[model samples]
Target chain A: MIVDTPLLIITDLVKEFNDGEISTTVLNGLSLSLDRGEFVALLGPSGSGKSTLLSILGTLMRPTSGRFEMLGFNLIGARDVDLTEFRNQHIGFVFQAHNLLPDFTALENVMFPAATRKGRETPVDRRRATELLDKVGLADRRDFPASKLSGGQKQRVAVARALMNSPDLVLADEPTGNLDRESARRVMDLLIDLNGTDGTTFLISTHDETIAGQCRREIRLLDGRLARERH
Target chain B: MTYSFKVALRYLASNRAQTALLIAGVAVGVYIFVFMSALIGGLAVLLLNRTVGNIAHVTIQAPDRDPVSLYGRDSGTLVAILKSVQQRTTLQSAAAFLPAIEAIPNVTSVAGVVAGNGFLTKGEAIAPVIVTGVEPDQVSAIANVAGNLVAGSGDLTIGIALIGSGLAKTMGLQVGQRVSIRSERNIDATLLIGGVFSLGVSSVDDGAIYVHLRTARVLFELPDGVSRLEVKLDDLRLAPEVARRIANTTGLKSIPWTEKNEQLLNGLVAQARSGDVIKGFALVTIVIGVASALLLSTYRRQSEIGIMRAMGATRRFVVGVFMIQGGLIGLAGGLLGAGLGYLSLLPFPLPEATSSTGLPIAIGEGAYGTAILLTFIGAIFAAIWPASAASRVDPVKVIGP
Candidate 1:
């Protein structure tokens, strides 16, 4: 189902940090592109700018210098509000910490992105959230508060939430970083199954080589730039 | 409910203890505001009632005559003529002005009074007194002489007079005892004591006397005129405007009770201003409480806010969630505090003139609407800073890096 169309393109992306008198470059002229429905793994060691690149790609942070376009929209210089609307409709995120609202139930957590975009929760959002929870194999735990859920269950709920809006692409940063081996395997299996069944593109950052091997394509970063790519 | 409000509610519900404490703080502030308002309002009403209860709201007296020039217009020489010192100016044809005075809206009663300085002599114990003479039936028209009578009745017949308890005690006079009242005109008459009153005012209780209008006219040699006219109104607050109208209707000098009690009015205004300052401080406390608590909430929910932002929720949405939390807290606290304030003041008894402990707090005057509105609006204003701070949460920092 993988299309040859370019879902996102990043060119000469540069990011730096300034601390008073010292300057440090995090991303130096990084460039890459992802095809539609591609399950890509971003591999890097610490301080390699994988998170920064993902942040820039997620429209959460602006790179110091770069040309970034996704789905034919120029994202590098867009207004924050307009970028937020674009991101809500077309991009989703799954964080390493599984940052679910601890006060909300699993079902509510899954429905949050769509509900927030629409200003209120509709029955269709509820149905889709329920179906996503079932797809993630936690439909029975949908009513449980996220804080009460185990680490693995929380990560599964995060995955359901990321896919709630049917976004074209999902940027997952260390999605299995905190999970146990079995939990991480199950989460990766769910992501791969969803990619095959729904044709949703995924760009996942991971430190584990085993996790990187599961992706259809693997890209490695060194000194903030793409060092190598294997398809 | 909207997603923002739902998120706010979930946040509050998750930390029940903290939310309850925050609401309690706001409630206590609102309670203080409501209690202070009711107490101050009641004190003002009590003071007004005590001061003007038995006094004329508007008094009509004869206008003073201006001295005339002795020179004729053709002579072109002015000579000042002094006013007559012996003659006491009286309101001539005072009965003719009663109808016009009574016609004023809200005027309750009017009494023609022959007021003059007199002496009460019982044996060799003689005391100077201010005499107020009114018709027998209208004896208590201007003052609550009948209601405050300590002994005998307020019957001011031809041979009967009323005196204050202090005067009676001073002269060793009792009801039905005969006493001689002599006017400044050197006219004297013997009358029996009809009533004794204690109005709780030192001057009136010590040196005031009430007699029949016919008796006073005969004694003061004013058979065709009264000294002044006393007019009472349903509401004492309307004295100034009513006084002006009465003055204009009848060519007489009219004075309102407010003009005579300027110092008391000033004191009341000062008291009210102090109360307002206290109420304003209560509102400030509410604002501070809501702001600080919401700021803490924003900090505690940083990662969650970051996640929502990364999920493509707008900064405005994040701000909306926090602001809604503040508004809900304020509304709940306001309602609870208003109810508690009213219930707290309910057991206290209404003020009475004779009651030793006059706790003048009118529960009905708690200004509930004002307190609630101020708290709600203040809390919303308080949320602004914390909400903005929440909206500035960097998703990249909290979510991963």
Candidate 2:
């Protein structure tokens, strides 16, 4: 059987931040690749550059030096506007803080990504958002504003929002960092079930070993470089 | 609804207090603007009507003559009397020219007047007066003297005269009083004062008297002649055109009242300029108030803006959100202010009637519309800077861990 092309490729990636004459390196000569439909966990402690790497993958930050390609586009060299469009069409992001707009209802928050990209919500998109909300087990709270939801419920809404556009790649950064053990397991189970059924690619960054153990593969980053890889 | 408008409305709805304050600020500004325009514009119209209503728009008179002095005080009172006789070089057959003058476009009414100097004597008081000869119905059509009759009627019959209120008071004269009226031509008659009038102009009130046209003809020894024609037009602004047409046809010296009173016209221009300056300052206040409010709102929603950008909203979309907020604020405030302004006028009483409709103040449609439009556009422009700032928000910087 022939193997399909990988969905992501990063080589010799580096990122630096400058404060006047001083510079701090965030990602130092990192390299990684992932195939389609793969569920990979990025494992690291604080200051290990996992979040920085996730930020770059989400198209929010540009690498200082790298060859980065996603879905065949050279992401590192794309213009700002083109990058925004590419991210809108192909990438979904779930933040640790569950950055749901407080002014919008849970349903509106879940529909936000698609609404922003499409400029309007169609019937199909609304139905998909409703189904996702049902899958997340928050159908009863769909009309509640995001600020009124509990921590776990908000994170679940963020998860539903990430899949709103049916993105090709989903990047989650400490998605369950603020949730309790039971809530964390439930979020992880939801992610695993979506991956298994839809074959959607996932790259989640987490410090929890139990969460890393659940993924199909694990990549460890230390001192801005990949330290270990396991499957 | 478009995405930007929906988002903007949601943001405004979430911050109810801030949105209300913004709307109130714009409403107050618009209200003041409308009120000021109405007050100043009404005042201007009232002043113009008061000055122009009682007088003829165009006065056609005989051409100028070389100035001549008949006597000094050393020449005795008889020489003085001769000097007082107004050089009555009447229009040659004034009746035949009336038809041509009235045929001029825009001329509504034309009345032939024989104006000469005379003296009103009652008991011991004697006052020099302008004795104006007029046909009762014809003069009433050109001037508002018929409306100003304070005592007696507007009847200008033979041997009966209409005297000014001020002249009547000074000479102890009243309606039906037998008064000695001696013209400068040395003709004397004891006439009854049929009416007493006040023209609202101090000079005209103190020194004018009206008599029948035939009676004046017999007194001044000018048979079928008039010194001038008082011309009224459909529109006062069209006086010059009508007067020019009349003068060209009748060989008379036609003068519009606007040209006759240069100082009054200059004062009106200055008043208008001052009103414009006040309006300009009011608009500036509105612009600044709107801009500052929007800037603060943008700053307060910085994180929300970043969230939207991360969700694939373009910079233009973000900018459009703030602009929509500005436009809606302007529209709401404009309507409220217009309503408030019109209502406020109801409680304040008006002065005496100066208009044909018996209204002291007049509302101008064009001025009201202009005030509302200027305020609306000003508010939109005021929001641009804040909208631009909102669009420039960086998602990576704001959302980074």
Q: For candidate 2, lDDT tens digit of each residue in B1-401?
A: 88778988898899899888888888788777777777676676677667776778999887766555455567544342222345565676777888998888888888888878888888788899988889877647765777889999988888888888898888888888899878989898788889998877767789888888887887677786788888888877687787788789988889998898788778878977887888888789888988899899888888888877887778888889999888888877777777787777655445335445643444442266776788788888888999999999888777753
The model with the greatest TM-score is 1
lDDT of 1 by residue, B1-401 (tens): 88899889988998999999999999999999999998898888777777776788898888877766577578777766866656677888887777777878999999988988989999899999988888988888888889999999886788888999998888888998999989888999998898999886767889888888888888888888888888989988889999999888997999999999999889989999999999999999999999999999999999989989988899999999999999999999999999899999888766443256767887767999999999999999999999999999998787753
Candidate 1: where is the Cα deviation over 4 Å? A1-5, B60-72, B75-112, B184-186, B217-238, B241-254, B353-358
lDDT of 1 at B217: 87
lDDT of 1 at B105: 97
Top-DockQ candidate index:
1
lDDT of each: 0.90, 0.83
Chain B, candidate 1: TM-score: 0.86
